[model samples]
Target: MTPRQPEGEALPGAGVLPEQTSAASSSGRERPFSVYLHVPYCRVRCGYCDFNTYTNLAMGGGASAGDYVDTLAGELRLARAAMDRAALPPRAPQTVFVGGGTPTMLPAGDLAGMLTLVRDTWGLAPGAEVTTEANPETVDERYLAALAKAGFTRVSFGMQSAVPHVLRTLDRTHTPARVPQVVAWAREAGLETSLDLIYGTPGETMDDWRRSLETAVEIGPDHLSAYALVIEEGTRMWAQVRRGELPLPTDDDEAAKYELADALLNRAGYEWYEISNWARPGHECVHNQAYWRDWDWWGAGPGAHSHLGDVRLWNTKHPVAWAGRVAAGRLPVAGHEILDAESRELERVMLGIRTREGLELAGLARLGPHGPEPTTAHGTPARLVPVVGRLVGEGLLEGAAAMAGRAVLTLRGRLMADTVTRGLID
Candidate 1:
């Protein structure tokens, strides 16, 4: 269940704590939460990217990046102060994740400065997991070592495909050879390493998908995240599809590749802990887990989103606007909504079902009694139960009998998840 603040009291920073509130002592009563920083600058924009990112050209040839960083540091200070006023006791962040257009795009010194700010403002917990996402082309032994020294214990590299043609089609600039070298560099630098892969591209075949999986596993990352390509509107890929320049896979074809990935990765000793994320035991992303479990997390950077208790908020998506607001000594908040109980519950279900831990059955039971086997707009609850049941029968789920008492998806349910979850909650 979502935690509630006392009625008639204003929430911290309008229900979002600033950086100061994130100090080690103010971590609240529960296990300390996580932190996510979005670095919205990229060297080149990919055709498929729908994230809030700007090309390097917009960074003003690196001349304005330092200014942006200074502004970010100032924002952090203000955030810390806001957190303090919120009255949340000091608590060290459990995990810190720096994700991006590409965090590696930042100069090593800039990256170090970001980490230092985090330490000074939030106070990293002892043994805190600090992770940074990088593109393969930008990582090297020197860069990897620098990141390790700066307190990044983990590195996630975008190794979307090992095939050169596929990489070209996706507008990724890295070569297949670059990925393993970077992985080796990261491991030698004493950082846990993970690689991301995308499958079911427009012209990608099942064989190609399998080859990509095999190559990624052979590179030996501690974690892997394989995602099926989604054609998001407003992206270059979507435009290509409209112009008949690319043909997407049929549902059956995509399903075949998904099944192949699951079979291969599971046999290769990776756990499918989430729909798209696979990790070796003890290597699951703690920061991401905080998000899946609905724990409080703070985001800083243009277009970053934060969820604190029942409130969800986002910063200005426009980099210029964000920078201008921060320069003016005001929080760059764009908009926010206080999520109601039902909305929060639904969000928990959607996110939880995507993970291996599934939803907590006991907690769901406490949410309220079943509503005559509640049916969503899509279908009857009874029909949905069997979809879950079949997954358990297939050994993709555990604790099925207990699930009848609580609506949770099995691992197989996670694989064919959209259908089952849509049926349950519409």
Candidate 2:
């Protein structure tokens, strides 16, 4: 998933497929598709979670692992209906990402079985990238090897902090020592490994942050995602800060931590392919790339979101409600919106500026020259005219790229990406 669509946020478009979408559907295929299955069951709710996840006993309708997969299979049929309605081609998914509520909490066989549903329904494209998010403590050699044999190509472990105090502050249950063991197990099982890290916790100090980064680098995983912790309104972390029991992480503090991570990870041969992600060459998460590059996808599970062509849809938030709706032969869509041209450009700049590729100036008519400008001009979008020059002067944008029809962020610009994007859109 894209960094923007955090666990709870899929709670929030169409573009061309990359020419290779030649799958056989009754309707001629025009674009590629990806599938994301959100397994909303977790062993314990983390302190900072606002995602729609339930504990084993708490899952209503007596939703066991088997029933949930059956429900997902039903939802897959609904997805096919939606695809047929939209005249989308039946191209197999290029990537499949099973996210969680700690997907590994379920038995490994259940995990593998869910992928089987995808394979039978739409089939996996050759060399498809399949990944499942796991809690470090949940998987053992047997479990990971099972996952690998089940066709999982990659596994991402949540290792929030390497410092014990930091882990305690975040209410993480796993010991820091367990991360290496888990990573080793996954590798031995022939699975590629990625580690997720979080910075900007209430009590985390400079050294604490440094220790976490150093520890993660020492593990030699293929990918690393270090996110600045945002206190979602109803989460325990937010409530603690509201009651003054925990200090809030300030902007400067987060900036320092981000810079430290960038320097260290880059030194460790990880490239900053996206604002919040670093990966070794050839190890970038394919599922994430599908999202960032704006391809079509179907999101499954309660409160999951899907984008096909220009229409965006979201499912109901509760597990029981979603299951009931799908069981009743409904699409389980709660609401949807259509993206107009301006809205699409806004999204383009918003998503594109954060990427290493940079945003193309041609589509942004809001930028560039105005007042009866020739349609033939290379960069004459009226709205972008003044802002581009101004940002380049401020050293927030690379001047040469701006002059040459792209908006690549400078180092300082990356530190203040939202502000830079806002200026372009405004």
Candidate 3:
């Protein structure tokens, strides 16, 4: 998805964001802070993925894997110094997530050392959730053990599909058998496990999807995230679709797959906590929750986005460019936007409605540009009550939840979540 445009003027230069200092300075009690470290290296790029990543370790200008950790350390130090300069209270990171093309593509030692850097720089909060995204083919039993020994508590594998043809279509390197092995190894190493799956691939059949889900259920990871395939523009899959080499996935096809996934996962004892994620009771991902719940996080590495209260900042997309700025004692911030109240409310509504907890009815009052007053008996904004009623009447939202002053989505609503988001926002 395209990033929400910055409401404020673009950053003056590639240095620190102009609003960063003020956003930090005016901070009151520290909110939950998390750190995201992006490892941009990949053994091979998936055809459908558009993440900022590189397969060439030999990319010069301090972007090679040999010195990646060191270069990233420079940015972390700069981040801490920036925080100190702005008198921001030093809060231990509640969670640390390492995501990438495949973070495990780096040596286990590199991943461990980076985790050490984060811990030493700002101590980890007690029981902090430390996670890294791993590709099944890139890691082994020994590698997972090393990461666990270095304080990594969770591992999310990119097990996009269990069917051979589906994997081939996505350009995924790992075979179907590798997922169970890595998941078992992560379990043995005392780390929580999560699996990510994608549905609605070009040539995927209903039986293929069902088989994948059954295999995943049998593997039984702590958490499962089944995302519908999205063919982003400029990606290889997008090009194929444009050329008619691959059929574009229809909304109906995707919606059916989504419904099947929910039913299968739910039968397997996983409950939906968010639109795309399910967990076994308390195994919900803390770092994922941090984003949906609007926690303050600093995203380090190329092209990662960070948010501090109303301010959102992102790094330069290219690793070489990111490294050069860090080497020059700069923040490598490409640009930032300070969110207005309306943008903030829109975001709150958009993100909150996706979760199972949903949003409180009273909160909708502040979503308007002019901040309308609550006029309903239960304090829902007067204008929004009819919209909620219409959605409830249409079976898109749960009528009981609406009466209880919460805007929770029914199964149908979850499938048409964007519609609900727009109705509430508009």
Candidate 4:
């Protein structure tokens, strides 16, 4: 089925499909899919954030948020048409994630309208996981109720730390008091709650990290994401550190804090599904899992990315350019690429190693000639065999059925996961 081009429309740039394309399933069978919508506006930019985002870029002076939403709706329509043409069966998206600078920065009505477009175009499945990233300071009773009514089942808040000093150091505006209140309000509104916490800040002590973890557990969020602070190039935080105005923890200290997080959250009944993410049983972020599992998900809005099997496409990063192209009845895509086998294998290892599930031994072997042997038959690599043997000997990793054939990370392994994964992939 070809998408009906609107009157006076022109074809988009190189490699961009014209608002629709044939969707022939590689397996000739229907597959489950997910959707991701990027809301790139934030009330204020955090010093450490490197996401493609605009601060105070709402409806004024050339930045018309209304126009942006309209363009998003157009993109949604094009995406649906593309799927329909592909001959892929019409299945409701298993998950929908609205991540941003801060999705809550948009007016509640505007945000609701965007979600409505998604539901109307893609058709949400019953019990589909719909999540939005919200700021703690933006969570009010009214906004929470509105979001729930709009079909959001999960809400992730950026509560970097529970201490005022830590927050200030992060240049975050919200008070720690707002964390519990937001979680309570979201829970009351019938949405599962998740919180993002940052550890290993310059001045953070073990006690400080412990307090943050304890407070998060006390609030009882369904999910928690604890990330170590990294100073990315071109970020204000990096510049400040270069000038010695701000300091970050050394790698060893950060590793210790990561270990501390594992101890606290695991004791609190949270499972570390991925390196930076934990959740209570059955509360994992389905949308994020889709990415880690390498499932096909459509991304909309500026700087968004989509992958259908091996082909990955991304939209223009500039919101204005994206909207203008869609307004002209063209797909707003900026670039696309079809990944080769080696690239896919590398990506799989990169993503897979970060999760509780290590790389599939058989799949890795099939990827190339240099792949390692299955742990079941030959155990770990020759270089690491002695190390694994010693670790097992010391009672670090359990040799159970769940971990029977895989070199899975133990709680201790998770702390030094990057180093271990590097050795394995190398």
Go through the candidates in order and give each one's C-alpha lDDT: 0.75, 0.81, 0.88, 0.76
lDDT of 4: 0.76
Clashing pairs in 4: 22-86, 23-85, 23-86
Candidate 2 C-alpha lDDT tens digits along 108-151: 99889899999988899999999999998899999999999999
**Clashing pairs in model 3, backbone N/Cα/C closer than 3 A:** none
Which candidate, 3 or 4, would have the higher lDDT against the true structure?
A: 3
Q: Residues 228-326, candidate 1, lDDT per residue (tens digit)?
A: 888788789889999999997577787787778888999999988888888999999888788887677778888787666566667777677777777
Strongest candidate by lDDT = 3
Query: What is the TM-score (0 to 1) of candidate 1?
Result: 0.86
Error of 1 at 28 (Å): 10
Cα lDDT for residue 201, candidate 1 = 87
Query: On residues 5-27, what C-alpha lDDT tens digit does candidate 3 reach at each position?
Result: 33435555434445444433223
Ten consecutive residues with minimal summed lDDT in candidate 2? 9-18
Q: Each model's TM-score, in the order given?
A: 0.86, 0.89, 0.94, 0.86
Q: Report, for all candidates in order, the number of backbone clashes.
A: 17, 10, 0, 3
Give the per-residue lDDT of model 4 (tens digit) for 1-426.
Answer: 111212222235432443333233334554468999998887777777788788757544223665667778888887776656555467678999999878888777877888788889978888899999999887798999899998889999999899888888888889999999999999999999999999988788888999999999999999999999987777887788889998767988888889899889999999999989999999999888888887778899878888776677777777777777777767777766666767777787677767876654334343236664444453333444554455545444345512353556677766766655565456
Candidate 1's error at 394, in angstroms?
Answer: 9.5
